[model samples]
Target: MIIAIDGPSGAGKSTISKMLADSLSMHCLDTGAMYRAVAYLRLHGDIPEHDEKSLVQLVRKTELNFHHTTSGTQIFWDGIDVTVELRAPIISQEASRISAWSAIRKVLVELQRKICGSGDFVVEGRDIGSVVFPHTAYKFYLDANVQIRASRRQQQLKEQGIIKDVKTIVAEIKKRDFHDSTRKDSPLTKAAGAILIDSTSLTKAEVVQKMIIEIEKIKEKLGKKGKTN
Candidate 1:
């Protein structure tokens, strides 16, 4: 089974998806990180963002990998472990831009589908449920208030020692949301048949547990149908 978790930045999709994947003994695919790695490559390599043809060629040439372990997921680009480097604020900004491009999104979506097709995966991204994996076995749309999401993002950046000022982080997050939501290709939105969860007041553990309950219900229904047949 594939569980597609779609949400805005700082809405806890990453944490919740990882936990859910662990509980189900499935792989967790952080689709956003893949795009961020591409952005990091573009910036460091001095590749222009508007060059769609070049970006598509670059993606075709690049090899991205996800390494799973007991602790967490690690991302590798071209055989180098760049798990931490891709999370930098600069790359985050660039990722939003790169992800908005139709050519880039098309290439990455094909890669993502190929990966998930081989194994059960818990995939998380802004458009995972809506665009990338619309026919997933279970789909969820996680959301939180804008202020709460901004505050959470600020705290996360501070913990990582990436940024100090909460105001600046919050502003950047708002800008990213605007860009992501208004993008022409596969803009971020909740998928039909997705279960919406307001995560503003819920802890990560709480949200995971709630999702587990929903998964169990689906499993039970499927099991009953199997027995009936």
Candidate 2:
């Protein structure tokens, strides 16, 4: 099965998706990282901002790979391990902007589909449920209040020894939410039939358990239907 977890930034989609993938014995595909990687390249490389053709050409020439180890998954861009650099706040903002480009979205969406096409993967990103895997049986839209979301992001940055006030983080997140939701290509949205889980007051474990219960219920229903057939 291809399970899609879609949500805005800092809503715990990454952590929860990893936990859910582990619990379900499925590989976790971090689609957001892919966009961030593109953003990283755009910043460090010579790709022109206004040139769509340059972006598409750069992406096509790039060899993006994910290496899974006991420590965690590491993303390599063109054989260079840029896992840490991709998480920078600047990259996040750029990812939000460049991801709106139709050409960029088309390339990355194709790569995402190919990676998860065989199934048994838990994918997380802004548009996974709505655009990448719309036909998947298991889909979730994880969200939280803007304040709670910003606080989570603040904590994450603090872990990296980069301190930022919650207010600044909140402003950045709100801007990202606007860019992501209002983008012309593959805007963030709740796909039809997706279960919305608000993480405003819930722990990560609680959210995972709730999703597990829902998945089990769906599987049981499908099993019984098979028996009847």
Listed per model in order, the count of residue pairs whose N, CA or C atoms clash below 3 Å is 0, 0
Candidate 2: where is the Cα deviation over 4 Å?
A: 68-72, 224-229
Clash pairs for candidate 1: none
C-alpha-based local distance difference test score of model 1: 0.83
Best by lDDT: 2
Residues 27-52, candidate 1, lDDT per residue (tens digit)? 89889888987887788666776887
Computed on alpha carbons, the lDDT of every model, listed in order, comes to 0.83, 0.86
Judged by whole-model lDDT over C-alpha atoms, candidate 2 comes out at 0.86
What TM-scores do the predictions have? 0.92, 0.94
Candidate 2 at residue 62, lDDT? 79
| Residue 135 CA displacement from its true place in model 2, Å | 0.7
